[model samples]
Target: MIHNPNNILTAGKPLEEATKVMVMVHGRGGSARDMLSLSTYINDKDFAFVAPEASQHTWYPYSFLQPLQQNEPYLSSALNVLEMLRARLQSDFNLKPSQIYWLGFSQGACLTLEFLARNPMRYGGIFGLSGGLIGPEGTSRDYAGSFEQTPVFLGCSDTDAHIPKGRVLETEAVYQRMGADVTAKLYPGFPHTINEDELKIVNSLISGQ
Candidate 1:
């Protein structure tokens, strides 16, 4: 009779046969089903794909540019959801952080960055589309952790209405400082949507190419 705030939808091979697990987070107003839909473009049956749905189809009800505290319990809850899923994968499925990958879009991308920043590790890969760190402009990150050379790919629109390019650049710099091998690409005058080139890059990342 109780309701869970997080609902997880899974695809691909089960945890036993699949050594790789991709955690896909959806943007604000997006569902776990929508996040799982991305698997259509990516052909990989060896990897397990999991997406977590946020309550009411939103992570936090404000711009990521806002102060971190402004996002409050909702943001914390969202990150906690990811943490739970990661822990389950490590415990139940006997998977390590290095075998786990993350891919997210828009608001979900920001969430991904924040979560990884709090819990640093050598993950398989990270792809963030049109998003960046969470907090106001010039917020002092001073985060204490290292990614240990994990590969991170960031793709953003130079003219995205929601996410400014400067934040993306700042996030890339932060990732590099945290010991991540970062690759950043900005499309000029691009809308808030993924393009073929980005998809191709994602495919390569997913395929470990």
Candidate 2:
């Protein structure tokens, strides 16, 4: 198992009869509480929010731009943490895969997106803020399985110093190939941070019809 410890931050209805659950992931140097704070803007009492912190405020040791293996045991371990959370949510609250959401920012966003791609399922939705799939310049992305029509939102700056626009497009393509309903937005002159517009869209996604 990955050696990193997890700090889980929870909010809302405590998983009891909640229609939706959002697993928020923080960026490097940020805590789970930092991500969970986003729930305040969402403010949906019926939906539960959970954020799991990385052992050292960072999921992996190297840039996600490196080769998959180069990120080391941390990458695999981070994925394992998500898997464990999913299993617990399923057994404890009888939550269907379709009722769970994955949300992340920056490095956390990269991790969440890669995890969903590797373990494709019918999640309620996926919100990736300032991030894309992990890999070097020409990493092969031969993933399988459909998202079963899950909605995926990819919001990023056109000139994000940390993330390349090409990778964002590639990530969108991968999700589309997996049968996901994808909505991608590239903000002009935005920085390497989440913006209000992105939060507005996220709110709409979680409060679907």
Candidate 3:
């Protein structure tokens, strides 16, 4: 496994006694610090946020729409980082999978979404902004396991140059099939960026019982 230290940023409370843990992933060409800033908007004094930095500021070399093998070891390594973090959090903090939330933007969003799909579990929640699953146009998505009714929110622009609307729809369908309570919104004419509506939806989903 890669030995890069995660540039984790924390908010709310310390992990030792936090009520919830949010794992935030930044997009390509973005740093952990960029994603960490979102914690200010998602001010939940009882929740702890952790953002992991990708090696060399990129998760993978090629586009997410490329053939599965084209992204190879890098993609696998990225997934391993998340899995390792999850295991560490659970073992060290006594936190259950259901209390861990995953959020990412753009390329990071694609990585997080794909990771959750491949390893379906009852997470605190999932928020993918302007991203979708990885693979070529006709790649099969036969992911197994169930989310156990975990809430997943996906917000993207209908005309996003990086993320296609069809893929967003497909991602929602796959998660729903896995029993996730998914809320997918496609903003019309919006740029490849997160909007207030998306943030509001995420805040509402995370700040609940």
Candidate 4:
């Protein structure tokens, strides 16, 4: 199963002593170690970071915008990995849902946002860099549950070749409707990568500022 705990990489404070836990999902072809490296930029001493390695270094075989069925069980399997990870963090580490955070980029960001949409709850924060919810142009997003004012940040390029601006706005709307305090920023002609401003916003969240 993709949920194997051994496949997860950890960094920063030990979970047992951490007051907050963050799950970092890596992009396509990225490794768990790569994600853990982001903890350096987050720079939160009291937070425990966890990142899962996707089988084959790819969460799915097709673009996230492809029809949901086209990605097959891979997409579902990837989501299950997050589900199990969350469960373990809560049960084993005794972290409440509000103490958990989520962050991802590109394909990984899509997966992370999908998981949050499917299973809504109060979280420390949710950061999606250069990505939007999965599925084609008009997929149904009738996800249920409230975020209880959980802070969420969506940052992407207005001209991102991989992620359309429209989809990012749609994602913001979905989260706002679900009661998340959403912040979306689209940079003009920005490349498909995270920017310094995005990092500053995330850092503010991590610092509780």
Query: What would the per-residue lDDT of candidate 3 be over residues 1-209, giving only the tens digit for each residue?
Result: 55253545666678998978999999999988889888888846678888888888898889999987898888988888888888889999999999899999999999999999989989999999999999988888899899999999999999999999999999999999999999999999999988999999998998774
Clashes of each: 0, 0, 0, 0
Global CA lDDT of candidate 3, please?
A: 0.90
Which parts of model 4 have CA positions greater than 4 angstroms off? 2-5
Worst 10 residues of 3 by lDDT: 1-10
Q: What digit string (tens of lDDT, one per residue) describes model 1 on residues 1-209? A: 01133489998888787889999989999988988888777766778999988888888889999888888778888988888889999998999999999998999999998899888899988999989999999899898889998889999999999999999999999999999989999999999987888878888876763
Tell me model 4's lDDT, rounded to 2 decimals.
0.91
The worst-scoring run of ten residues by lDDT in candidate 1 lies at: 1-10
Better of 1 and 2 by TM-score: 2
Q: What local lDDT does model 3 show for residue 11?
A: 64
Top TM-score model:
4
TM-score of 4: 0.97
The C-alpha RMSD of each candidate to the native structure, in angstroms, is 2.0, 1.3, 1.3, 1.2
The per-model lDDT (C-alpha) reads 0.88, 0.89, 0.90, 0.91
Clashes of 1: 0
Give per-residue CA lDDT, model 2, range 1-209, as digits (tens). 55343458788777886888999999999988888888888856778998888987889999999988888889998888888888878888999999898999999999999999998989999999999999998888998899988989999999999999899999999999999999999999999988999999988877773
Error of 1 at 31 (Å): 0.7
lDDT for 159 (candidate 1): 93
